[model samples]
Target: MSRSILDEAHIHPAVRSIVANNHANVIAEVKAAIASNPIVVVGMAQNPFPRKARRVLDDIKATYVYLEYGSYLSGWRPRTALKMWTGWPTFPMIFVNGILIGGANDLQRLIASGELSGLVAA
Candidate 1:
């Protein structure tokens, strides 16, 4: 999937300005993390799913980066943009190798199915 359409920097100048102004450094931070980290988790402080996902990653000894947004702050704008961009309707948007992997439940399912282990191993 092409990530350019979803990236704030690549979007329209007006939209990019809005997201940048509202989110400050979230978009840049997320972009950097996704580019540099093999596994990235984007979630909010109030969301338990991200924490659960983190726990699962830790249990599996997976190297990942967790980007925590806000439940009630300026960071929520970037979170909303990311949710829209990814077309995912929940928190803890997990990405493996720059690919979306759903949430904690999805991670658990992958773990149960042994697919996540394979991905992490590779």
Candidate 2:
């Protein structure tokens, strides 16, 4: 399926600025997070269309895990792992460092505000 119209995967100016301003720190933080927790980003597949979200994850160099309840039932379902975001019904759910980062829109907003880099740094 095609990507959703609401998919704002483009890197915002604030994100670019944050990266440019704190490149070394951001990279070090991200590396540390991934090194500490191999599964830093989990991408749940709530919808059939997930290109945009996947692209965003790829751009950020985050590991993407597709969790489609219908496709397969495993010992650890993505929903079960991320029990906090019960309000949202779709997939492409992003989790950074074990924290719920919302869906595509939320990610875009975070990037736009430069909070994504801060979160990574934190």
Candidate 3:
């Protein structure tokens, strides 16, 4: 269940700090949202999946928070920071009760199976 990460001993000492703190502000923002909100969606602009995810949530009348980063044209560095942080390769990284439940299609499956309703009050 966990992905492999470089051990501290294997990484050069000089770059450890840089690796740890790269785009830390963005991470902090998402972390803060996760801590405070029962459901959080980390997404990027101009991505249809994120929009679809939002629409689905809207249909259920779920209370959630959404954080959007860059689009196809710009702001990718921050998005990369998120990808590295979560190890989830795509956008619309939906979190419920601070647990990442995967993206839009995943959300649809959860909804269809009636699993997501157990996590968040709709």
Best model number under lDDT: 3
Better of 1 and 3 by TM-score: 3
Reference-based lDDT, each prediction = 0.80, 0.52, 0.92
Q: Model 1: per-residue lDDT, tens digit, 60-94? A: 88899988877855566678777766778888888
lDDT string for model 3 (1-122, tens) is 98987888998999999999999999999999999999899888899999999999999898889999989888899999998889999998999988999999999999999999888763
How does model 1 score by TM-score?
0.74
As a TM-score, model 2 comes out at 0.45
Model 3 has an lDDT value of 0.92
lDDT of 2 by residue, 48-122 (tens): 335566676578776545433333244234344333223445555555555667677777788779887777767
* Estimated TM-score for each candidate: 0.74, 0.45, 0.95
User: Which RMSD does model 1 reach against the true structure?
Assistant: 4.3
Shift of residue 47 alpha carbon in model 1, Å? 1.4
By TM-score, the candidates rank as: 3, 1, 2
Off by over 4 Å in 1: 1-25, 72-74
Residue 112's lDDT in candidate 3: 97
Better of 1 and 2 by TM-score: 1
